[model samples]
Target: MNDELRERIEHEAEKHALLNAVKHDSEADVGAVVGPLMGENPDFREYGDEVPGVVAPVVERVNELDTEGREKRLEVVAPDQLTELESEDETDDRALPDLPNVDEDTDVRMRLAPNPNGPWHIGHARMPAVVGRYKERYDGWMLCRFDDTDPETKRPDLEAYDAILDAIDYLGFEPDEAVRASDRMETYYEHARALIDHGGAYTCSCPAAEFSDLKNNGEACPHRDKDAETTREEFEAMVDGEYAAGEMVLRVRTDIEHKNPALRDWVAFRMIDTPHPREEAGEYRCWPLLDFQSGIDDHLFGITHVIRGIDLQDSAKRQGFLYDYFDWEYPEVLHWGHVQIDAYDVKMSTSTIKALIETGDLDGWDDPRAPTIASLRRRGIRGGAITDAMANLGTSTSNVDLAMSSIYAANRDRIDDATDRAFLVRDGVEKAVINGPETGEPPVHPNHEERGVREIPVEGGVLVEPDDVPPNGQRAWLKGYGSVRHTRDAFEFTGDGIEVVREEDVPVIHWVPADSNHPLRLRTPDGDVEGHAEPGIASYDPDEMVQFERIGFARIDRQEDDRTVAYFAHP
Candidate 1:
């Protein structure tokens, strides 16, 4: 082959090798690599009679390059094109049910209203995924509404506002528009005034305890009889801070003898002395409650549907009263029961989790023990896996109590094919002296040979996990090497190659050159485990997932020189 032809072949071969490495494969088939290049550049296949000879040298050169280096080059060459390699045939079984009454002119809109009191946990994550699926199905809009009006009780945090957005984006759901309840205080006030003018709401000056007692006895507060003109003046006074924090509140008028006492004269707007973290501190004292604020925003934002937890049915009922007073149609409401994973001991309350984080009882939100989306992302769980799990749950209203095994199983299925395999020996290392070739190269991935190989300089000593070292005289197979017998302080070589010499279910243990392994500290749900990983691990970027030969999959959290920190994802 001419030098120019040789150079062209070698360059295309390098690109193909990089593509395989980027997918975490050991290698690509010669045809898989060559066909794409030929399709992209017809000149590469111009050599009619000498095609095999030209391709043979190019393949050899490609295989000789390091897998890690190829991955870096691939990132530079085609950053946007590199995606997870999942088989197309691996279809999701749970498809979204068809949305009702959606058509070309239908402006389908939904909102994920999260209280910005704390970071989003796993339970809170499903809402966005569920609504996002519908949004996709209808080609509609999603509004990320921050229900931050309960500043005194729930206490909105400035950082949590952005954190919620980040979590939603991490789940692969981007809102079409974002709104904050604190920003729309004037709009709520207008609605409150309108409600008062219609005699549907009244200002209650009775002490909270007294009102609770009267409401429990099916009696209205003394102020409930005041005319609209009087209530409007009291509401104006409330806006002007004439009353102390709990001395007065605007309550929506409802059936005094309603079966649910909570629905009787529910508080619509109240005074909070605590200043909001994000908004101008103490600029406005009167704040709208969730029911009033959501009820107003739903109409203003043109929301066509509302999907929330079944526990919030009372809130919907309370909001419906406001809708009736204004003669406004309420959006279609759907409630799903709570999902509980039995494996978690932590209550899925954002407030409780925030308190735990503050007291240092747990690590920050991304701690493996916490079920926040940040923690899952840090632990290397893919967004697709989370969406798939949510889809599988469907639109069931019945409460679900399941084990973590199903989630891990779903995650494993999505990630297994793309995760590169490496040797990681935990709980300290043991030396295995093998009597074999001085050097070896194992394919980086077992299924794909074109991905490349990892160099192993085997001058004798190989590092193996202490547990993998069998009892004296017992046989064990050194992965990528050969079968060996355990002797005192050393592994005596008993076989010639990787082929099995004895067939009594000998354990296949991964090993690395004793001096070449890097220190790896893995944080798991149970606790931390220390180990040594093959040096190739250093090449992985933070958040990249990799499988430990016999151990489970782990995502690299960070790397500092020779030490690497990883979070155990799943088995």
Candidate 2:
């Protein structure tokens, strides 16, 4: 782990230690702090042996402070984490921690800035989802900003601008207005000029390789000490396209000997000769880099809080220099660590997904296999479920692996009652029942009798999964109907034999009558599962969620050629 991540874990451990200290008369138990810290950040769980080493010092430090000092320290580190200390009872840990320093009455403005290169995947959903939750939590306004400035390396697709907004809407957020960085080129230019005049930045003609060598050695560039007037002339010339792409760049002025090489006078703006994908591609050539562009825009747009990934923590430092130059106060920043979805092994990189799509190795963004928001939405995963799962992760700077089961659990509560259950058998084998009922009337849902029963036409020829029948030909219960004995040739069905089914230690299996079964094509993340659905499945309309008894949950997509196409959610 990097020092930054380690530092974050130490901070969390300290917060827990302080809270425990305040709770127990200014002396904290190491056990209390370590348990809660491990719960919040999974990273600590792996390095369990090292946790006590990290926590013992924190516990010692907290015990030195008085009750008042402990409380004050806890408030500074985690403002709203303190519980009501009057009762000395157990405290309720709310699923989502409240955003710190929020004034619910004020117009709290947060933003979702996405580079419009591709549609949002599962990882990208967290930003807008959290922002939307916090927006409602604080009665705040949200802005959808398309960071579409880069046209050469990370080209912006024209469709991705609207695609990202669609994703935000899919997450149940409506940004007050959508803005594009490309549209604010003139504003970026104006600020670049202002920075040169303020003696905060200067144009440098250093070759790219030479600058890298000097920056690595902590040496100043040749044009570092130029007067503001001369820098202004050079900046104007660079902006007016006098400099070819990569010939010159506007660099923010900072300590040349800064400890971090990346922080030493980073490039603010550069010329890109490649035609931008935007309609006004030819109109502008000089584009401000991400740090400079977002620094200026965040102030201009009045964004109060910015939630981004922990990997870009240095961007905030880089933007701070710009903020200092303009004498502007920086917005509150929140960073989250990487989120890995456990269900899919595919990397959640947009560029990687786009390349796979282009190569036809995978389907489009909405493919059942793809982990994009569009894929989930198309598969009938509710927006509320997505947002709730994301909000549950909350704001933690530890690498987390998210299980798809958690998502399924959240969605099950949402769709279980509303969906009707039916019988669906995949890779079915035909069997002749010795005494089968003419019709089977299973309730739409076992939990709700008022929903009524579905009339399924049962006949001698029943279709059941080949695996459901024991190879040893043992007796098994045919669910909702009767007991059956799988023989070498066929199954001998017994009518209403609940006692007989309970007597045998047997598996209860669901079956679709061959005569009444409808063709079904189930699209799942694993792959397509072709099956036969009971006649009851025909009653449900398109986009309706349903449970296939003994199988799993699915959403009815559409009907074509007497076949029902549905998307399988989970088992």
Candidate 3:
């Protein structure tokens, strides 16, 4: 890479890495520096360290998407593009409209209805955190409503639903109850029948091409004039499996001439030929549209508040119309913006990130790059860190794209007070010959006098970081620990001659004896690191988080045998 490109990548990586660090370390200094930048630069355009030549390829690739595909991508890539519809202009003669009142005393029951289409993504995790906060603050319940209306989307791997429930519980947001839309189909059918009987819905037999235009154009169809009795017959026939998939649909007789396109006649229910994972194929022919079903469900369940992403603002409006038509109370809604990490000028999505995990382009979902909750947890990011990050961006209607360094810094500060310290050899190198005292012990942490330190068992031969050693006969000392001297051929071992390097160097890394009965293996950036147990230090428990003295924070992964142990790093 050219200097400019290399610098850009490094800068982006550092910005993202900083958030990971804060969440692990809880660094206040970082917050002081980046907190003010949150809303001041909502677009994050000024942070572009991109080279002039690098813009062409990105522009070219984005241009390849079709119009509808581009619109779909905008929700994730550029949510600011979304525009809300304006209500009719108020005239002086018109009566003032009454808005719904919300207050502390309001019984605000909110819900998060996520479709169990695939594994829960970062987006899914974000919903609960946002909604749960409101519920906790207002003493409300955030119902976990499973939007299983479209049976095709429901998978055989029901464990994904269980995982989300588990994740919600782990995050301390247990729902009051679980409700599946599939089980409530009878209620949806009742609403469809009501609409048909009221002459507000009709059966449309338009082909795909004609329906595509009808969906957006706000143009009436010939079928819209069908009598209520005939329409009701067709709908009941739909219920009784008279229509095939895509052959006929019950559409609401919304104002087709409305300027706001989504307000036009919308599909109320349709036939799905696919099998339901939870039921036999062809058992049910009619399925309610998402907006209609959600509207009815929310009203029936008495959802007093709806907290969701800004991208779904239109969904709230559609449901609002339904509330007006049915004369039901509408819920108060709060639309929070999306979290955008600095990714070298490209936006990221949970689906794309998940694909990277499955394809081995990245590690599992917990991989730091994936941005999933598991990834954040695996990175030693405390829950307080994420909460702090969200708080940094207070509830605002404005959109904000942030460099992740700030959040990482928050996490780092959280773990700093509790982290224990230890020495680590990133790459193996033997220590130089003993020059200071024959034996010495390094404190686990610099300022911690009472916590005590792990003793290093050193002898004539010891290992260290290879890069820390010098050529020829030179001296290196391990700070707090004993020293070592290097010679061309100072020692001999039973294996390859590679073991003959002198054990003395400048503060060479300490290591456990290779022949020790209890050996500890650690996962680091380079690979697994092997060590021996200290004489007095007790074996670490599975969840015990400790600093390897000079090394970083780590949690015990497993106790393989009585003598074998594994450790994984965080942050």
Candidate 4:
């Protein structure tokens, strides 16, 4: 082989070796890398017999590195593959990275915190799905905590609390404990007083703009050196409702010169006068910030592992000082990159959806067009599909746009078996089928025979989708029923068997009896699709998924007084 070819072969070999080793605990196998190597690099075909010899040494080189070392090098060599490897078909059989500092005897505890602002969008499911998986792996405790502290900016919705727990139950990862930060104000106040007495936090009365300037410049405020007694007195006053909104704040005593300016005496608590929707939560004028609230709760509730987003890495740094002051061990932290869903029309924000709903632009949280968990459940996207999709993505620390195709594929796998096949003719054109068969039996489920059949009553005329019509004098088959010859504005029954359409390569499409079918209005993400379906369509219970042959899958949304309605899922 030429020098260029030799270089290419060695480079490819090392790349595959690193990937394989990273996947299998820093241990690579020559056999695993060889097939992918030769298959992807067809130019090495002539020398395929010598490929194993080249890959064996590469495996040795890769196996010499530890797990982190191997993964670090892989990121440098091929970053995208690190994510793709996690999202591959191996998700069903692959294992996640081991939880740090964990053992068989360790008491494992986990938590998922939401603000209770609105229903969880698809992006919001990642953290709980990941933590829930870990909880199962170690038989740990899981807590669903509502971080509803920001009353002014992110006011808590009265209804989202139950909706979130419902989503968790649907995902099959219900937590052992459900809590709200707002309801635990006394606990937070007690901790704040203790921290103040310990000289770990102090009251800061600086104006908002001044604090921003000082924090940005890594300069400590004048109040940082106040005595603990003074700070405690001020904190008591604030808890006693002495300070108005934005008049003063409480900050942790971290290093002012920390390299990351965000860690410079970050706000631990603030005063918000906005009345909370919940009567119990509305009584408090003082609120703890997210970091301080979650930091204290993590230790108090015994949360051992924390699944966090990469954007919030600074939160860990900010909380580390408080842990130091209290002599507490921080929880095991895992930060994954963002999962930006592509090809989804809706913005993945709770506040945005709420605004749209208020403006009459959206129907509700469960609108078929929205991407909330409630919407997904209503649209027949199973909860298992969401969790399984997160498993396939894993915890790779590279922000990648999760393709819509993966979600569709996962949902398709979940619903394909239970879904019964039926016919839905869009923009139907009635045609007289001369001497047509009176009765036809199509399997309710194409893959399962014991499920029985859907009796499609064929009358003298059939309703066919306009798009399925063939040219004049062409043969067509009403799927599973019989063959018919197309005439001018009608069909002539030609044979009882399907062989003619199969042998002659004729068009075959789904059909419904013109006289016996019911009206259907399919509400898809795009818009409403009006059509006709077989009489058996009404037999399905609400929320049951059905496959309209050659069209797509849809969920039985409801039974309108005048028609049957379904939400289109996917093709």
Candidate 5:
């Protein structure tokens, strides 16, 4: 254990001891101090049967002090630390700001519409939490809409649909209803006809290059001037397969001379021959563009709030025209700026990551290197931590690049109080024969006596990491055991009891009985690290998060009869 962690454990134990001492009007009981200390610093509970030995001295020291001295010691511990502990018991009811124009009578509805082309990454995962917070705050309904219309470009994969749903479910946001755009083709066609009938949209037969040149020159295509009836005929002909793909396109009647070229005469629908994976193959050819479909769906689905990334601001602008054409009220749209993680070597793009997965450059969507929600979850990052991190970012419009350290710190704060610790020797392992009692049992958690103990049969040598073994005669501490002197061949136990060495520079390391260890394969973000883990590790369930003594935390992935696989989470 590092000195920092040890100090924290001691500090927490002292606080508990002081509280117990004052409550009983006598010296603090070892059990009273150990229980609350373990509750506060769960990592200490890893000491198992040795928890009593580790905390007994602290309890004895507190007992040696008089009531006045105990009061003085309590004062010495910072007041803020005590306040922090007290605040922890209070519930976190913090919520997002209320939506605009919403009241008891106003129906507040939101939707998380995602293209089912790939698995949801960390970037995609933020929406559900943001929307879910709003949903709870306003008691609104949330819809999970799959925008799987463009099969030619952002092609829909059958597996991706379920994967997206699974990702949303993992985030703990259960949508009130689920809808698919592919299933509502006729609705989009109806809207297209209405637009043509109202002269709000037109069918253009101009060749792609010619229309692009005309639009660039601030001129309209000949087809753009065609009458509503003529445009309707062309649209029907195109939809009936009379026209080959790209021979005609349905363009919403935006200004041809608009400052933004893309905003000028945007394509509402286009012909694509690529077959959709889910819907009947080639049953539909004319696909509605994302903006067109989303606009129609949002209004039709009674969505009152549209929360999405600022990149979709153009989509909202295009949708505004359609809303105006239909004489419908546009939903309140809120766009948040991009969230960038500074630790990522490359900006996380779904399409780029998908290509990497296809090329076998990555293991899968859940590969630790990827920022997918699955990857984070696989690395033992809790969903609550993810939500907390996002909430901390708060709805800021400015693009922010956050450090991975900040994210991991938030996660560590959450899991630290619950996760237990264990011992593992990485790289080359050296055997240390301690000159101590024949057998020992230490509490699995220094603070949690109820977790029971692990038997350490001293007849077998204890396994220690090679780097932790100091030079000859240098004092070192075997955690859960006492102080020892490192020799060339073995660690000579130099203490008679489990007393913590006050020497600040002495290194402390975790150890496992050589005979009671099994081979461990730890999958880290960098690569697989081979090590020897205590036999007790086999009892942990898959996905259980545990801190490796003197190492970082890891998630148990699986355990076969002989070999165990784990994923390194963070330090």
Candidate 6:
């Protein structure tokens, strides 16, 4: 058993003991329960509720001691639970598809190939995690392959590639090897040549436009009847650039009468005139189709497992056919469904979004509305929270509607403990003058004394949110500390209040002073609005997510430049 897991079980026991004693209104030995595993296991956050009953008494005992005694005796585990403690260790470390008893002799390898069409989206981020998680669970390794084929569609952008690798690194996955399909063209050609030699494939003279009509009517190509030797010669000629782009294609001899016509004599190779990213630009009449290349790669790489989204499940079967023809061993295939993002009619394609950013129609990939990883980070979302959210969405064939608000809520929970309180002025109006030293500075956060507070100093003038500015003869509470009254062009408050602005008579929003220049802004869904708070407004640390009193949570985007400080308005 690993030391980490052993310590976690014992720690849970101690916590249980302390809580029980504390509930009884007695001094509990928190130290005894928390000390043993404190340094050993930094990973254990909160134990799941399904802890063993045997450990409950240990926690209760720890809680019964006085504070001084508790500190000395608060060992996580008693000496008695060693065997079960080891069992707990194994369980905690175990991952899903639970392959604990796999024979050590069996070698397992897998591959995760992502298409380099655009920046990897959140949906694709889960791909590497799933592969890596399963690989760790089964004690296997996985290859990271760049499926950069299709010269007409593939764009060679190092930035996108680096971003993908960075995201993979962020997810803690290291590929056993990295491969690009574009680099293996020669290998694909060898397989194509072998298929032609065996008479399983032949060159077709049918025009590209005729494919649909032929598939629909079960019409055979004119080149189908040519002898194997003659077809081979023509295929070689085609590869050597003897034919026009659409003059001929190499096709697998499949059942033309099959119910699904897509499988009927599908093209195994095609002629493309486009300049290749890796290969020298020449007349390339022989290009292995996607399904064909993937099949060959699986064999050469010895991929034992293939986990991809359900969208590609059929690709697995198509490649399986190629494997059977080539007498290659098939890998175990697992299909995860797509993440149907709830975007409220936003174009979900990464290409469109990228175009918008590049063309200056949108800010950048990190724009909060873009839904990229950088965007999520800028919005103060936690990586673990995204992982946890995806966990709730199991590997079922069904898709889940992941609302944007749900993601924000998860982020909010993660930063709740770490963030400080801030006051922001969204829409402001000057309140009645307090031209004296009677009003003191307001604290940054109420109730968090240890975090202490930054002062929002009171001057001759104070800015109140436009709604908070009451009409003549009304009272309004300033929330958290106190209340004040508003009269004709003046403001006053009494601890024993007579009359001015009554709380019921006036409803006002909260805002900081306009002239203090503490550097803050009210960020709305449309755009950011720059504003200022009272002088010496609380110091907001970078990336520190805080809730402005009554204005919602906003993270401090800048420290040095007051005008550049941006806020993410809470939805």
Please provide TM-scores, in order, for all candidate models, with all chains considered together.
Answer: 0.81, 0.81, 0.70, 0.82, 0.83, 0.72
**Tens-digit lDDT track for model 5 on 313-391?**
8888788889899999999988789888754553488888888888997888888778788888898988766766666
Residue 525 miss distance in model 4 (angstroms): 1.2
Candidate 3 regions off by >4 Å?
A: 1-101, 153-156, 215-217, 280-282, 342-369, 378-380, 397-399, 402-410, 438-440, 445-448, 470-479, 482-538, 549-551, 561-569
Which candidate number has the best TM-score?
Answer: 5
Which of 1 and 6 is the better model by lDDT? 1
What's the lDDT for all of these models? 0.76, 0.78, 0.57, 0.81, 0.76, 0.60
Q: How many angstroms is residue 226 displaced in model 4 relative to the true structure, after the best TM-score fit?
A: 1.8
Using TM-score as the measure, what is the rank order of every candidate, best first?
5, 4, 2, 1, 6, 3
* Poorest lDDT segment (10 consecutive residues) of candidate 6: 48-57
Candidate 6 residue 429 C-alpha distance from true site, Å: 1.8
| lDDT per residue as tens, model 4, 122-237 | 88887777788888888889999999988888888889999999999887788999999988999999988888888889999999899889888878788889999888888888
Report model 6's TM-score to 2 decimal places. Answer: 0.72
Better of 4 and 6 by lDDT: 4
Query: For residues 120-165, what per-residue lDDT tens digits would candidate 1 score against the true structure?
Result: 8888877888888888877889999999888788888888889999
Predict model 3's lDDT versus the native.
0.57
Cα deviation in Å at residue 528, candidate 5? 0.9
Model 1: CA > 4 A from native: 1-95, 100-105, 496-503
Measured with C-alpha atoms, the lDDT of residue 109 in candidate 6 is 81
How high is the lDDT of residue 175 in model 6? 85
The TM-score obtained by model 5 is 0.83
Residues 314-362, model 6: lDDT tens digits:
6776666566677777877777677878552336667787788888866
TM-score, model 1 to reference? 0.81
| Whole-model lDDT, model 1 | 0.76
User: Per-residue lDDT for 1-571 in model 3, tens only?
Assistant: 3666445533433332232222223222212223223323444334322221122222223334454554454445434423210122212112111113657577868898988665554445556766666676667777888787787644333555686777677555789888777778889999888767767678988876796687676667778888999888888899998889999998887678777777677788998887667653337769888888988988888988776678777787766656666777777777777765553221255457656767886666554455566655654556655654554554456665544554455655556566655544444544433334444466665445687866665554455545545454554444455334456633221121211222211223344432222446765433456765443334666665655533445665557755434344432
lDDT of 5 at 196: 92
